[model samples]
Structure formats: structure tokens, C-alpha cells
Target: MTQTDRTDTAERPDPPESSESVATGGAAQAQSQFRRAWTRFRRNKLALASFVVLVALIILAVIAPLIAPYGFEEPDYEHTLAGPGTAGHLLGTDLLGRDLLSRLIYSLRTSFLVGFGAELAALIVAVVIGLIAGYRGGRAEQFLMAITDVMFAFPTYLFAVLMVAVLGRSVGAVILAIAIASWVNMARLTRAQTMTLMQRDFVEAARAMGAPGVTIAVRYVLPNAVGPLLVAVSFGIPAAITAEAGLALLGLGVQPPTPSLGGMIQDGISYVTSYPNMLVWPAVMLAVVLLAFTWLGDGIRDAFDTTGTRR
Candidate 1:
């Protein structure tokens, strides 16, 4: 065939396409990606099981108030620290005869709140710093990176403790502390990704067309950078949760009356030698939740990675 015929054939639309068909095609592509990811994720049976356990734990947390026979705080001084499987006290009682299971459920809720809050804050800071640093590449980049470097220099727990000390010990303060220290890593990650995306053909084309800096950054750079950022966000949640737990362990987080996984674990520390189940069960749940998030992040990272397909 002549070159003209070949070009025309390549450009031709499919025969008799309707809006329904276009919608159907788009849905099919989405389903295909979903199925591919499911297939890959299921291949790791341990990860799949961990994800299921995490989901169940979250559901239990949401329904804890409804399910508990006794209130989390309604103390039964008459039956303090009753052994496991005691009358109406499922999973046993705390030092004050408060339901261990109920406390655990509430703790999960608080931990997740801290995790999500910190993750979102980190995402925003990272995107802004990364975009400006990557695109501008001069004084702004150096200054922001210098700040990020200072954050990175301290140990995670040490940074968190200092922030809480300065900011005082509210839930928001704890979350803010973790977010401030945590976001620098994400900023560096996003900045590296933005640098790569800025060099791509589409970015060059946008620049050639005289697109505004904000427009090009948002439209061209950000979309390309989103997958890695999402993966980072997923992984970052576990880190944030761990940070909150560490702060609570140090008696500087979540405060009284607001149960967090860390706080629950801290409450059990005194009784750990006597009733180790109190400490053991909470630690296990925290580990499982963190591992599930890490696995999910890994799966997402692998799914979005074109290099996997190339291999």
C-alpha cells in the first residue's frame, strides 16, 4: 500500500461507534487493569490474607460502641482486671474493668485517623514543594531542599517528640508533628519524579506551546507524577501510625479519653508481665495493619510500574 493509504487507515475511526460503545470500551479498560492487579496481588497469598484481616479489624473498630456489652469507660471496679473470658467481659478487662476489646476497637479508629490525617498533610506539602523545586530549579529548590534535609537529619521519633513538646499534646498537634517530620521524604520523592516527568516529550510540547507554569505543572507534570505519589501515600500511612504510637508510648500523644493503639499499648505496659495478652494482642493488631498497608503499597507500585511489563 502507498504511504497515504497507510496513514488514512491508521487514523480511521471504528465502524458505527455509539456513545454506549465508547463507555463500554472505557469500562472494559478499567476492569482489565483491576483484574490484572487482582491477579498479581492474589499471587501473594500472605498479602491477600493480611489485607482481609486489616479490613475486618477496621470494620470492628467502626462498630465497637455498638458491639461492646459494657462501655469502654464505664468502669466496673467490682471486677477489675478480670481474666479473659470472664462474665460479659469479652477479651477480658483492663486495669479498671473496662472492656479490652472495646478499647482496642477505639484505639484502631484513632490510629487510623492519625494515619490518614498525616498522610494527607504530607501529600499536600510534598506536591507543592516538589513541584516548585523541580520546575524552578534554583534558589527556591535549594532553600526547600535544605529544609527537607534538616528534617531528614533527625530520627523520626526524636523529631516527633520535639514537635509535640513545642506544639503541646493535642490530637491535631500529634498529627501535625508526624506530618511535618514525615513529609520531607515524600517531597524528595515527588521532586525526583517531577524532574523525570519534566523531561518527557509531552512536557516539552506543552512548554513549546507557551503554557503557563502553573498550567504545565498541573496538567502535564502532576498527572505523570501521581502514581508514584499515590504509592508513597499508601506506604506513608503506616509510618504515620507508627509515629503516633511512638509518641503515645512516651506519654505525649492522643491525650486522655481519646484511645489510640499507642495509648492502649501504653496502658497495658504496666500489666505486661502479669497479663501479657493485653500487650500481645494490641501489638499483633498494629503489626498486621502496618504490614497490610505496606503490602498494598507495594502491589500498587508494581501495578503502575511500566518496567514490570517490560520485564
Candidate 2:
């Protein structure tokens, strides 16, 4: 066939009578990529373990209320400060006689909520900004990168603290603050990936096929460029969780009558001299959860590296 025929073929919409071969091939490619990625990820036993633990943590957080022996706010004055296993309060009680286990579970839920919610917001903003900046290059790219640079210059936690403090320390506010603070990394990641992918022959082919700018960016460039952003998302979650925990620890997060891992830890610190378990469990959980997120992110990065270095 002639070049014109090939270009027409590339740009032509499939007729209603067309077979499913094209769709099937695309599905097969996607499935193959996923299968390969999963294989690479599984080869890193620690990352696989981390992913499993992370899922378990999310499940545990979801079921916390149903499984807890008592309400998070229910006071057991008689059993106040009770050590582990007292009256089936497995993790013990805090100074207020609240079951530590119940509070811990609920607090965990809050932390994870902040993590996932904030990361989602950040990713949305990042993807949009990155797509515009990278695909549109020249003046648009320069302007967008300038803004991203300004955002990066500010300390992320400090920005979050300022935002949450101004907006009041609610869950939504915290998520918003973290999003504003953390989207820079994702934006930069996506932009770099887009720039790299835009130079490839497939992108040039799409451009030469009379594709509109937005269509090419969205359908061809964005999807292909998301690999780096996927890794960024994995890392961003932990950053968000830590940011929320820090705010809570400093007494700027979820107020009293509400349980959050950081707030609970702050409360536990007062009694840490006498009751170490109060401070220990949440701290351990935070560490383990963050470690899991980091491991999983690393695994995903390696899996999608495209360098064929993954074993």
C-alpha cells in the first residue's frame, strides 16, 4: 500500500461491521504488560510482602469498627490504663479508659484515608499540569515548569501545615493541603516522562496522522507516560500519611473526640514514661506501613523501568 493509504488506514474510524481483532490485540498487549509487571514485582519478595501487608492494613482499617471490642470513645474508667489482654482489650487502654486497640484501628483508618485521599488529589493536579507542560512545550512548558519550581521551593510539610491551619484541621482540609504541597513531584515526573515519550516514533506517527493536539496528548502521550507517575503515586501515599501524622502529632490534626494515629501517639507520649505500649503500637504501625509503601513503590519502579534490568 502507498503512504497515503497507510495514513488513511491509521486515521480511519472502524466501521460498525469491523471485527474485534484490533481491540483484542490492544487487550492482549495490556495483559502482557500487566503480567510481566506482576512477575517482576513478585520476584522482589519484600515488595510482594509489602503490597500484601498494605492491602491487609487497608482491609483492617475498613473492618476496624466491626471488629473492635468497644467504641473508640467508650470510656472504661474502671479499666483505665489497663495493660494488654485486660477484659479482652487486647492492646490495652489509654489514660481515658478508651480501648487502645479500638482507637488504634480507627486511627489507622484515618491515617490511611488521609494518605489515599491526599495522594489522589495530588495525582489529579499533577497529571493535568504535567500533560499540559510536557506535551505543549515551548512557552507553555516553560510557564508550567516555572510554577512547579516555585511550588517545589517551599517546604512541603510547612506548606501543608500552613494550609491545614488556615483551613481548620479536618480530613478534607488535610487532604487538600497535602495535595497542594505534594503535586510538584508528580507533575515533574509526568512532564519528564512525557517529554521522553513525545520524542518516540509512535508519537510522531500519531502526530502525522492528523490527530488533534488534545487527542494525541490524552490518547497517545498521557497513557504511555503514566508509568513514572504510577511509581510516584506509590511513594506519594506514604508522604501524605506521614504529613497527616505529623500534623496530628503537633496537635494540628484531628481534634479531640476523634481518633487519629498521630493524635493518639501524641496523647500516648505523656504517659510514655509509665505506659510504653501506648506510644509503641501506633509508632510501629506507622513505620511498618511507610516501609511497606516505600518497598512497593520501589518494586513498581523497577518493574516498569523498561531497561530490562528487573529479574
Candidate 3:
């Protein structure tokens, strides 16, 4: 009952309540969390409305080329600044006589394009640098954090404008500018979350179990950190959009006759007193985008809170 009994016990498989079970149970718990969150989210009237509005805007942007009645570039001077419900143009024309509705559709697409592209670029850089900064610590952390500090010190709008100016006022430029400007925030967030998550017992357990550093960070630390990261991304999209618009407003974004929202506002501002509608529509659209994103972000934040159901 000594050596032989010890050997047999050691050879026995892990118990049913071991790590594998924990994984399975954790997955189920995650699913349950998602269901609960969704149930709560759906009950939020403002959030639901905002979600619907965002979906509709996305759909419109996607189908713009096919459904736009008139080419955004095509202009009818006779209809310039015409009030809504004109002969042919529903929303009227801009200073260049371009179709307002069509231009707006394109602008929405461009805004979303820049937002998503910038976030993607930032995400790539942030994930790598952030994980390294958090996991490696010491000099690596110091260097990376120092760089982030420098980025933070620079004015966000000015930095974006300068980058876009260097790159030129195109869609790619806008995306590149915002990405470069915005990545610091994401990197900081990632580093903080990673540092926190890396200290968890599960992460230590993974390390004890001989999991590689990258594996532990990617598989365990990152997944848990993704919730807040996702919230950051949700918030980041609107910020990017606003940045793009601001750049365009300064005549530093998409070239004229292209129907960018910022450009439209710029044009409409001159005639705001005479043609309030010109500024009105674009302003409303921008407001809607801002509000929708805010609500969605709030809803997501509430869902992921884990503290309570109220948002």
C-alpha cells in the first residue's frame, strides 16, 4: 500500500472538476453573461433606438452608390441650397450644386470608413505594443509608456491634422492620421488591462502549467481583457469620425466636390443664416452619429460592467 499505491494515484486522470471542467464551465458562464447582457440591453429603449439608427445609417452608407438618385458630383445650380422636398432633390444641393442626399450618403460612408480603418490600424499596433509593454515590463515598459506619453502630450486634433496634411487629404490620409493619433489610447488601455490580467491566478496557473508567454497572454489574458478593449473600440469609432469631420472642416480632408460631411458643413456655414437647411441636415446627421455611438458605448459598458444591470 506504499510505493505501488502512490504510483497508481499519480497515474490517475484529472478529476471531473479540474481545469477542463473549469474551461467548459467558464465558456458556459460567458454565454450566460452574454445572454443576460443582451436581455438587459434590449430592454434599453434609448440604446435600442440608437442601435436601429446606427444600423440604418450603415445600410444607407453601404447601398449609397446603388440607391443614390443623383451622383454626388453632379450638380444642378438651380437647386443649390433649395429647401427639402424640391422638384427632384429631396434634401437640396450644396454650394457646388452637388446633390445633398447623395453627398451625405457618401460622407457617411467616408466617416465610417475612416473610423473603422483607423481603429483597425490602431488595434494592430496597440495589441502588439501593449502586450509587450505589459508582459515584458522593465525597460520595455518604460520605453513604450514614454512613447505613449509623448503622443498624449501632443494635441489630438493638431496631431491628426498634421499627419493628414503630411499624407494628403484623402481617405487613406484620414485613416492613417487618426490611426497614428489614436493608437496611444488603445495601447495604454491594452497595457493596463494586460498588466492587470497577467497578475490573475489563472494566468499564474497557466505559467505554472508551462504555457508559453505568448500563449498565456493571447489565450488567457487577452480574452478576458477584450471586454473593456471592445468598449474602448466602440468609443474610439465615434472619436475617429469626429476627428475626420474636424479635419475635413478645416479643408484638410477629402478634396472638395467629394461631398464630405465636414466640407458640407463648411460650405453650409457661410449660408447658415440664409439657408439654415444646408447646415441643419449635416449637423443633425453628425449629431445622430455622435448620440448613437454614445448610447451604444454606454449600453456595452453597462452590459460588461458585471457590477449591476442598470446602465
TM-score of each: 0.82, 0.87, 0.88
The sequence of per-residue lDDT tens digits that candidate 2 reaches over residues 164-189 is: 88998878888888889999988998
Score candidate 2 by lDDT. 0.84
- Stretches of candidate 3 off by over 4 Å are 1-33, 309-311
Better of 1 and 2 by lDDT: 2
Residue lDDT tens for model 1, 274-308: 98767877888898899899877777767666667
Residues 248-299 of candidate 3 have per-residue lDDT tens digits of 7788977766766777788789999988878888888998998999999898
C-alpha local distance difference test of each model: 0.81, 0.84, 0.83
In candidate 2, position 215 carries an lDDT of 78
Worst 10 residues of 3 by lDDT: 18-27
For all candidates, the clash counts are: 0, 0, 0
lDDT of 1: 0.81
